[model samples]
Target: MLGTLAAVPVGERPELLAEPVAKAVAGLPGILVAEIDPELADTAAFCEAYASPPEFSANCVVVSGKREGQVRFAACLVLATTRADVNGVVKRRLDVRKASFAPMDLAVELTGMEYGGITPLGLPADWPLLVAPEVAAAEAVVIGSGIRGSKLAVPGALLAGLPGAEVVENLAR
Candidate 1:
């Protein structure tokens, strides 16, 4: 006889993983993927649902801006307790005319990830990955799996392994 299975909400389904995120993490070693019980597809929700308080405190918020007629996006990982100094550091480093939080629709379209599920992994190879130096110091960090309800815990080193990640000290103030 087949046993009855409990139904799970879309935001809490364990198997609802994103393909791109899986592909990006395929060959990485020593990484653990966890499914969150609460919906963590957005920054605020993610911070609230994060189990490790410190991790939540140092969350990354992805932002997109325009410069020289080109669209640029960056993953600004900062303390959830703090805000990324976008205007002072990110804009200056990217040499952009304007820097602003990318709209949810554009962020999803450009990254090919669901809103609130966007992560640095699987991002376009050309897009810059700017990480706060302090976050890099952690042994492992939890990041979105390109879908809600799932997160990937990866070694700090793996983040730098991405094609164009640049380590930036004081990325946020």
Candidate 2:
């Protein structure tokens, strides 16, 4: 059941939030987009409110780094139970001097996704998407729908179908 919002027919929904995901799903073969109640944009708060142990929610983390003097960003999706090892794995993988969480404003501007709703679906093709294997193992996961007022339940495989998503083990700690 779709939750309350100005509902747009499946074909007419805005591309900003759900459309990219829809397109990604189309290529993946067989995944359905189930809608869920939107929560406050804060990951911690969302986990506390909906997650079983209040800490099992997986958040899409955006990290920024400079490689060869050119700035780049990578997104890592990890469970709230553990933090994305941005300073460890991400920095090493990107071969950068330093890596830090992108500021919310910058994240929003670059990704065209709200602070809390940044899914990898519509991210820039060149941006690397490192997904924790644990997350990919789950049947379905709840994630932001590119808007603050909605959420989406999508299969793990669908997530991997995004342009540059790579399933990595122990991406988080």
Candidate 3:
């Protein structure tokens, strides 16, 4: 659960979300959005400043790899307390020889989100959204809102059900 920061139904704060993220969560249920200092968008800083627990915050990382001269991209969602198994599970899932966090510039450009606020919502339809089981089963979790100035809080089940999302066991460590 989030502390101190006031959270409102996401639908009521479209301005707090990036365009694509706004559209993606437009009619979703049980989603809350809160405004935060852009400077504290990073998970550790945001949690510390907002009095939120690190375990209840989810990090969305953009991963990419090349295979046979083609590039593939995916979004991996893991709890702030864990790290995604990018080179192991993710590389095998994407059928790539290696997987790594995508460059910040490319991630921002492709997701149409700020550098530190790329959430799993509104990723390109073709991009696989791999979610760790821990994140998908949490009662609630805080995640980016596609903008540095805000964050979204939602039930883990909601994230697991997002379009393109695939809950994967041991996706994180």
Candidate 4:
């Protein structure tokens, strides 16, 4: 069932879904939720097991930086084929003197989601959601559904339009 995109009441209210993912899917149109095995949570395993194309999978990374003794966070989303421009583009865009990936513990604590399942959908309102232009241009993208037990299939434009989301060029390379 990994690759089969099962039918799980992903209606206006995805009741069977987890809290963080359900909250997000309930609000967004044209989004589907698929329950998956936690053991196959990582992108590579999930994709291979589910027959998903790596091209359609997006990874959400938590980036952090400090300026004036303040730490800031942002969620950078790029396709599996590329990596986020963390030190260069991210640092400059965040306007932080320096930027680096957030610590695993901090990311988990702040997002209130599993370490590998932190999604842009329910991140802090203050944190920016930086989406690569290519990702926004895709028909749909597969992203963590707030937990390792599932993934959210959502339209790229919808993701780009999320409250804190911004389409940025050179986000990934």
Q: What is the lDDT of residue 172 in candidate 4?
A: 97
Show model 4 residue runs off by greater than 4 Å: 7-9, 12-18
Candidate 3, poorest ten consecutive residues by summed lDDT = 1-10
Q: Give lDDT: candidate 4, residue 156.
A: 87
TM-score ranking of the models: 3, 4, 1, 2
Number of the candidate with higher TM-score, 2 or 3: 3
lDDT-best of 2 and 4: 4
Global Cα lDDT for candidate 1: 0.65
Model 4, span 1-173: residue lDDT tens: 22566734367435434566566666467777787888888999989988988999999999999988899899999998899999999999888988999999999888878877777787888999999999899898888877788787878898899989999999999
* Candidate 4: 10-residue stretch with minimal lDDT: 7-16
Error of 4 at 127 (Å): 0.7
lDDT values, one for every candidate = 0.65, 0.68, 0.94, 0.83
The worst-scoring run of ten residues by lDDT in candidate 2 lies at 1-10
Instruction: Give the alpha carbon lDDT tens digit for every residue of 61-83 in model 3.
Output: 99999999999999999999999
- Model 1 weakest lDDT span, ten residues long: 1-10
Model with the higher lDDT, candidate 3 or 4: 3
